[model samples]
Target: MSTAPLPDLVKTVIVPARPDRAFAVFVEEVGAWWPLAGFSVGGASSSVAFERDPDGRATHLVETLADRGTAVWGAVTRWDPPHALAFTWHPGERADAATRVEVTFTPDGDATAVVLTHSGWEARADGEGARTRYDTGWELVLKPFAEHAGSSR
Candidate 1:
């Protein structure tokens, strides 16, 4: 048993694009930007998608396998356009077994300050390890998002 407290991971990047564009590229084009090689439940070659409904509602973030099967990585809990998005994040795990990930796109002059905060690890059984892992994990995941946001502008 460990007495280490669960931690909240926060990472921020200044995207060259505006707030709306940064948010758009981050949420809408996730399949193109998210690195699937090392971070997917669909294995190394899997493709990921941030699926949204016709009504501007985010449905699921899923990973598609080479064999065409799918893994539900998370569900969108908040979908505020061009500003903020919050979701449950626990790929290949039960829906209830999830942590909360919230990202905010703040307008910073001509650029957007994209802040990502992952929390709720206190509820996880593997709290300490998971907290430490995602401390590094989000940096890997969001690196491409920053690049894409810059390039798409």
Candidate 2:
């Protein structure tokens, strides 16, 4: 396999909600919309959630397996409500091999434009392969998030 550095994978989705509401739903209600069955480190029956600190700040993203075990996907790197959220991403791998995912919510008229940028691929042993999988994976993961966020009041 070639050792070329992969470009950042950027995906954008327009959600029918204000930036504040959109960001809230994305971070707080992620477990409801995230497609755990296909995207989880654990099996199909797993559930994902953001673990918040005592002050209600998100500190880490975790997936709970069917057998009651847990896998820490990543730690929160940036958390600005209604605007941006960023974290390290290494679902089944070591934290040292984690990539970075930064998502921004921009107000667009009556809706919000949510942009996700996945970078830092070179940290992983299979950076190119992982980037390829996540390119398509983010599409599937975001579809449900858009739908669920749109329907939320």
Candidate 3:
């Protein structure tokens, strides 16, 4: 196989909210909008959240299994509200094999343009295959987030 790096997966969505609100909904209310049943290590009944520090800053993302066990999806590397958030992603895998994901929110008139970029695929053994899956996976994952972000809270 070739040793070339895989291309980054980029997806964007426009939500009917300001940048701040869009960012908040994406991070704070992820458990409600994330399609856990389809895209989780812990099955449908599992819940996911950004675990916070004592000062309320998100430190990592964790998935609480149906059996009360937990799987750490990733650790927060960058957290800038209403603008950007990034982390090392390796759900159901070891941290040493983690890839990177970065999301940015920009104001677009009355809406917010949310952009998600998943990269660092070369770190995984199945980098190309995983990238191919996530190429479409993000669409399924972000649909609910866009809808929920537009809905009244």
Candidate 2: RMSD to truth: 1.5
Against the true structure, candidate 2 reaches a TM-score of: 0.95
In order, the Cα lDDT scores of the candidates are: 0.84, 0.93, 0.93
Candidate 1: global Cα-lDDT?
A: 0.84
lDDT of 2 by residue, 34-138 (tens): 988889888679988999999999999999999999999999999898799999999999999999999999999999999999999989888998899999999
Candidates in descending TM-score order: 3, 2, 1
Candidate 2: list runs displaced more than 4 Å.
Answer: 1-4
Off by over 4 Å in 1: 1-5
Off by over 4 Å in 3: none
Go through the candidates in order and give the clash count of each.
0, 0, 0
TM-score per prediction, in order, is 0.92, 0.95, 0.97
Quote the positional error of residue 17 for candidate 3 in Å.
Answer: 0.6
Per-residue alpha-carbon lDDT of candidate 3 for residues 1-153, written as tens digits (9 for 90 to 100): 226798889999999999999999988999999999899998899999999999877899999998999999999999898799999999999999999999999999999999999999988988999999999999999999999999944
lDDT of 3 at 124: 92
Q: Pull out the clashing pairs in model 2.
A: none
